[model samples]
Target chain A: MDYLVTHSPALIVALPLLAAFAIPLISRLGPRVRAVLCLAVLGLVAALVAILAVDVHAVGIRLYTFGATAPEMALPGGYMVPVRIMFEVDGMSIFMGIVITTVAVASLIYSLQFLNGQTGQARFYSLMMLLYVGMMGLAFTGDMFNMFVFLEIASIAGTGLAAYRTNMADAVEGGFKYIVISAVSALMVLLAIGILYAQYNVLSIAALAHYMQYTTLDMMALGLLAGAFVMKLAGVPLHMWAPDTYTVAPAGTTPMILAASYTSMYALYRITFTLYGGHIDTAAIGWIVIIVGVLSMFVGVMMAVHQTDIKRMMAYHAISQGGYMLLGVGVGLAVIADPVALANYGRDAMNGGIFHIINHVFYKAMLFMTAEAIFFRVGTRDTNKMGGLARNMKWTAIFYAIGALAISGIPPFNGFASKLLIYQTVLSFNPVLSVIAMFVSLVTLASFAKVFYSAFTGPEMPGYKEVREVPKSMLIGMGILAACIILFGIFPGLIVDTIVAPATEALINQAPYINAVMGAAP
Target chain B: MSALSYEAYAVWVPIVWVAALVVIGVIVLAWRNRGQKSYKKGTAQTDIFLSGIKVPPEEQRHVKAENVYWGFFEALKGFYSVLMRPHTGVVNDYILWFVALVAVAILILVLGA
Candidate 1:
């Protein structure tokens, strides 16, 4: 047990992967036993995340290379390999892992009943576990190339989950589109990786960091990587697949996608600022991101406003909120040239960007799960057909309001804090973009207000007028997610200082991160 | 999250910068602008073209101002289509995608050598 604590990062990745494989074999066992085992795996991962988080806080950055190979020079001369596939735990990665694993726990609990009559329950749970494995792997791993592998793993699992219900044409179509778009992104990322490997022989982020000469090739590689990530993040122009996919996929799966969206974005942070080491001038690319972000915000929200389906609206808004995140990243780059401004804009802007990704995951999950409840009771997610759901599903209504308020960046919510920082950073960095972002936020607020007014308030429609509260499993998931949103809102500084701040620092402070992986030069 | 925190409460206080005061003053301006627009509408409202045969305009051709992107969406028709397809959404296709992806990884690994 003590040994496991020291190697908890492995447990974090392992328990889920093992469970995923183990579930199919256990199909012959009682359903209750298999379900308990799934819960236990989630519990173990959650415990591992908490333990690793505490350990990282104490140790600063807990590096556990895969296969227990120590970081060492593989051959004589300049050649060195990072020990194993390192599960490098800084505050940010651990925090993300905690959120991801915690959410998986909730979703699985929600799934037990959701998948009650659904055939292939074992397969579904297996895919869920696989997704968690990849998500944890994505968050914890320090290397860029390794990140891609994990992404592929997660994407495969996600695609499976998206198509879990093959009877629905929407699910099948949505899942296909999801896989194709994600594959295209992965290909672009691979080409970028190829370019990087040619420039720097080693694939380890630490090795790349040491070789941070910003040649045109390096810049081109970065461009490819960024383009790919934007697709994965479902940033503007590349976000066409999300609305359909979210609408069709099981509601339990939608939150994971939202979580995955930000995780990919975080991977980009690791790539650009960490591996490349702020060496490449990215003002041009950042400006492009800002424009895209602006477009995504207005465009995504506008499209969302026209949606009668509730899940689709949340999906589009996910894309829009994604814009807010990238806008922060863009502002960080555009304003971070001067040392004085760099400290303020670079660190603060990145903090806000990263924090918002985490914040969005919580609130968005709450909202999605609430939508799930609506669908469960009303047997539909059509806003035009729903009204006065608050009267019956009081807890759901409260949770949904919390999600809506938080997402809209209303005061005293999680979104408000992050958006405020992002807005402030943008305003100080470039007031013009800030002005555009402010209008975008206003549109977002207005759009969500429409959602609330249409679906929760307004005149009570007949068909779903007698809708009862959802099962206990569903409420539990929504409740935890809603609680997370409220906790993050008031005490953001606490989480930000520990998790977001450290992650931002890790991204920017390249020297230490590189050394931590590669060790000092002989 | 910045070291120099711009606490909203502090920034939003009454006794702030001149620009801040000017910005605060715009709420009233916007309010007044809305009021003026409403007043203009009050006088402007009349039967279209003074009781001429009033054919209701087609819903699609409504003359209200709409977003520019409403038109832009059609221009970027290719872009909009990207959101929709590759749609034979079989689980087997996903498996194929993964297998192809894995093959690419192996190819990259071998070719890199």
Candidate 2:
């Protein structure tokens, strides 16, 4: 029964794709009806995601293979029957599922008025729905090639969303850069997949991991894969695309885009740990990845510190925060290849990395949404031109401040908790790593201080002087994120144990992944 | 038992890695701290590039970042021009980057195979 329910992971993927198509068509019939329909799909998605999260919690492993035959779990004595297209739901998938759906529900509800008031709102909702489809697809996919397809689908849809405000030249430029960079990244992914397919004759990641059997393909696939995902993950040198796109995208779509892409990063983890068998030595590629991560962290924060544009600054900080997440994951990978190291600090590093990702998605999305609200109210994303508007938009200021604190890793905010975990993990491994992570945190704090001072605290400029508070719907969206930010910040353990642990386990435990696809237990 | 070259490059790679990392770390830290911090009381040789560049109390400020990477590009100006690159503001350079990337990938994979 669980298998039947789980295999229907396509529904998680399909609901939004179907909704996206349905939204624009329904909007033509009636605007009010469109709102209700979008909300209904959102509600259904949230409920289903919650149900799946519960299933993952109760059961250690749940496999949902598409197009079912007699469901079989072969024991040690029996050989395997290949039932390919599957969604393996463990703890991590569920946590990400919950976060994605919850944010979708909130963002869509907020966009009701926000989009309704704007022109071509039907198109906006459709793009957003497709965006959700891509993200949910990412969270649930247990394979790599399919991950790229969804990545492409999401990226193209995101480009359209960024360009929705067609009146602005910068917005159009952002969209162009976004599409071009993402296309290149996607090309890299396709080439990498081609390489893997030629070698393995399989598209399923779990099968490939089993087939690896500790061969050259292990390193080859990984080396190829790291570059492919490095572009997607926006690690350092490849991160040039993110700032411009995020800065110029639609106000309502900003958070959703970050949430979607970040989920892809989570998928990268699923590929590395679950599909690749977590068998390769971290020493192979660990240093290169760590250096890139560290550089991104420092560079992101440094550039962010200098930006007068609020959205652009946040974009740089997003790149930096992404570095923190990657740094932890990279460290964990380094040691996971060695049995002795895996037992000690490797698990901690992995824990910190995954934890930071979850914390990051919520806080970062909220931060972006907060930026959006400010944009809607002021008609600009420039922080230097405006000040003292916080007094007028009190709730927004509070929410923005909460996000600012959280992103800076300030105590009791979600960012601080995960960052602390990362720092602790890195410290246990190497003194230098701890210093770098802490330095990133400090840089993050300093950048946000600049944001607060310039954007919210300075004297109210001419245009913003009369700007009023945004719609209640927008506040509700932020309010939900604000609560989660506080909730996760204070009780990092809950998030760690329930969500992070299972996902981490699924990533670390190569046995089931390989065993599922291949007949033998290696 | 595996054909993976884990040992062949081990000794040199580790030393090189350590040296590169130390150098990179110091460089990154220096770049992050590159700005006005009020340190000197100096001479007529103080220019914008000099740390002791004299200015009225308010005239001094951090360098604008829009053109911060100008020097690096200036050094590569002739090469970038040949490639028709950097600030052409044309979308074709981006397309070329993709083409070159894919070409490199194909070459590597054919060899790897």
Candidate 3:
């Protein structure tokens, strides 16, 4: 058990990577075998992450040094800095790990039938595994350079998946746009890492955070890191690539991309809170985040209402929902200096943001799966062409309604719980921001209601008379997420107490992270 | 099972709201049922009505999805027009937006610092 706990971090990432390579070879056996292999591999990764989360909760941060005899050995010569690649499994990282693994498992199960009989099945599964590996590695790694490497891996694999359907010219175009944006963002991140390494002679995030002096170069590097991550996170004015990619990607793969986006959002929060906390102007950067978030919420949803394509509208909703996270965390960051506020409201705000990450994953994936089911049956992405599908696709309709309610922040669903936290906390910080968030939520409901009315309710359309419900395996995949949504919604306190609170603590407290990496501070 | 509590704000079980909804729904259902005659299928009473005139189902105009929010869109016509102008669906424009954002972020950070 101790061995499993000790090596879980490395195993969680490494096992999937090994399986990703092994998949193509296994593909020669049969497609069914390949599908089973993918599921088993992802299931194992999920179990490992669950174990790691439990271990991190039971003890504390789990710091594993690569090629070291001991996990916490920072320096061979007893030097005061970390020089080796380390996997730092804190509460926050483990929280993100659980989210990624859970969503990846569900997505892989969904793809079993969603992409059945399609050509290049083996390649699709392999790329999916690689994307999973990249997200897990990005979430778990403590080194900045390692993060950049993982980001590249995720981006490349994601681009391939987005362009998987080569029959569609738009798919190829979307992939091209994604790769261009990813390359530029990766360069910016790499430049930031280089500047940090040149200044501190270290690639370790915790080490640099401890030794950071907030110089001019450090500020520039911070901007670069923040901008690159924000771009990757699909923040508005910069979110133009998202709708195209989401619309073009295979249905089963969109959820994975959403997970990847959240991983980058996690990086953004990590950079702001853990890496640069107390060393920079929190209010200035917080306001910057808040502004970006505000714009994203307004612009993303407004554009969504105008979109006729169902997947594209959901894609815009993704950007808007991401804005809520940024806003919640930004409010917390903006008030970090006030101990009273930090204790009373800031922590709650951060909790809201982090909680929303998991909730959004479940509901958004469900929504995408529902959209896929609609597309599968109706053979169209346009809502105008899809009416009264509920008569045939009963399960799909129910799942879509659950997802629509959840995404719109309606009560008795996960989105409402998290958005409530964000609203209450941010309202105390600034009433106007809360008002904007509420307005956006209303618009979100209207947008999804548009989808519901067009795609599910009203009179049955002429062309879809022959359509039926999606396959059982697809329902099973969506059922998992729908169940999670209901559970998380009904037990918000449990989730907040168990997962979000510790993660929030881990993010705000940098001293323990630094000490874990560089040894206890003398 | 436990409720979400932050400071003085508490959201316990959703049962209360559910029960209230059930009760209100029952009342509404009962009220509508009071003194109402059951209409037979394919009768004049069952036909659709527009401005006090019955219209045949086949001939009735079904509201399109785009028309559901027509009033809202009409009210915000100017806003939607300007907001959507930049979403050109072109890769070059997307990159331009990204670079412009990065520049704005850098400027904010540098100047704020």
Candidate 4:
């Protein structure tokens, strides 16, 4: 037990990575053996993350160093600055861990049947495992260079998965676009990392935070990192690749890819709140984040409201949902310097923002799966070509309704719980932005309602008369997320008090993070 | 499972609200059950009437997704036009927008500092 707790972080990233490489070789045994192996590997990783979450919560931040005499020896005895790579499992990292593991396991279950009889099954499973490893590493890594390395691993694996259907032109095009966008943004992030390393002479995020002076060089690096992550996260003008990539991604992978985008959001927060906390211009940077978020919200929804393709519409809404997260956290960042305001509303705003990330992941992923379920059974993503699916695909319809209501912030769903937090706290900070957010919620509802009517409730279309409920594995996959939505909605306070509060505290307070790596100032 | 409150400014007790909605739903159902006893299914009473003209077929009766919000689309055409200008689906244009954002962010961070 002690050994497991001590080495869980490394195991979480390493286990999946090792299995990802071994999958192709394992496939020679048999498909059944390979499938069992994949599930067992993912299940073990999820268990490890849960254990890590508990340990981190009970013992504050936990750091495990690679190539050290001891796992906890971030700084060796004789060295002034630490030289080893490390995994920092703070509350925020564990929180993201919970999100990624839950989504990955469920998505894998969904894919079990969604990709049945497809060619290259072994390679598909391998790429999926690699994607999971990349996301886990991104959330846990303490070193900036490792973060970039993990980001590339995720982007490349995701590109391969996005183009998994090589026969389709759109699939290949989507993959091409994603790799192009990812390569450029990753290059920028690398440049920023280089700039920081040249000046600060450290790769550890904790060390950089301890030494960040907000010089012009630091500002330039910050700008590059911010741009790259925002683009990666699909925030507005940089979001063009998302609709295409998301719409063309194979079933089950769509939600996983979306989770990758949220990981990018996590990186953005890490850089802004942790890396350059005290010396930065809080109000200016805060408003900049807020503006990008607002634009993303408005433009994403407006575009979604007009999309004819079901997947494309959902992709736009994903961008819009991301904006809410940025808005809430940006408001918090803007007021971090003012103790009075920070105490009054900024903390809650951050809570709302951070809470929304998990909530959005669950509901958005389920919604995308439902869209894919429709495509799987009816052979069309065009809403115009669908009608009265509820008559046959009852489970899919119910799941879609749950996801739509939750995402639209209707009563008694998780989306309302998180959005309420944002609306109330943001109203205190800025009423106009709050109003715009509420309006966006309403627009989101209208858009989903249109899709529901066109796809599920209308007169039975001739083409879809034989459509049926998705496979049991797929239903089980969506059922997990839907259950989370309901549970979260019913117990919003419990979730916020336990999971979100620690993460919110972790992000807002930089001293604890820095002190964990470098002992508290003499 | 209890109420979620935010510093006394707002409270959301979803369980209570859901219960109330259920009760109201029961009352509405009771009220609905007490009316229209004379109406018969599969009779002339069920025939559709639109401005005293012939009703459209079931297929035509259902609205297509694209036409669901025609009025909103017409009213907001200008807003959408300006918004859609940047979404040209070109890779170069996408990169350009990202570059512009980086430049603007650097200026803000430097000047603001």
Each candidate's DockQ: 0.07, 0.03, 0.44, 0.53
Winner on DockQ (3 vs 4): 4
The TM-score, computed over Cα atoms with residue i paired to residue i, of candidate 3 is 0.96
Compared with the true structure, what per-residue lDDT tens digits does model 3 show for residues A105-162? Answer: 7888788888876899888988998999999899989999999999999999999999
- Give the alpha carbon lDDT tens digit for every residue of A452-475 in model 1: 776676444555557888878777
Full ranking by DockQ: 4, 3, 1, 2
Q: What is the per-residue lDDT of model 2 for residues A286-314, given as tens digits with 9 covering 90 to 100?
A: 66557878988987876676667888889
lDDT of 4 by residue, B34-58 (tens): 9898889999889887999888878
Best candidate (score: DockQ): 4
TM-score of model 2, chain A?
0.93
Which residue ranges in model 3 land beyond 4 Å of their true spot?
Answer: A520-522, B1-12, B15-36, B51-60
Please give the distance, in angstroms, between residue A309's alpha carbon in candidate 2 and its true position after superposition: 0.6
Residue A130 lDDT, candidate 4, scale 0-100: 95
**TM-scores for chain B, listed for all candidates:** 0.42, 0.28, 0.66, 0.80
lDDT head-to-head 1 vs 2, winner: 1
Lowest summed lDDT over 10 consecutive residues: which window, candidate 1 chain A? A68-77
Better of 2 and 4 by DockQ: 4
Best candidate, lDDT-wise?
Answer: 4
Instruction: Point out the higher-scoring one by TM-score: 1 or 2.
Output: 1
Worst 10 residues of 4 chain A by lDDT: A513-522
Instruction: Arrange candidates by TM-score, descending.
Output: 4, 3, 1, 2
Rank candidates, lDDT, best first: 4, 3, 1, 2
Residue pairs of candidate 1 with colliding backbone atoms: A66-A85
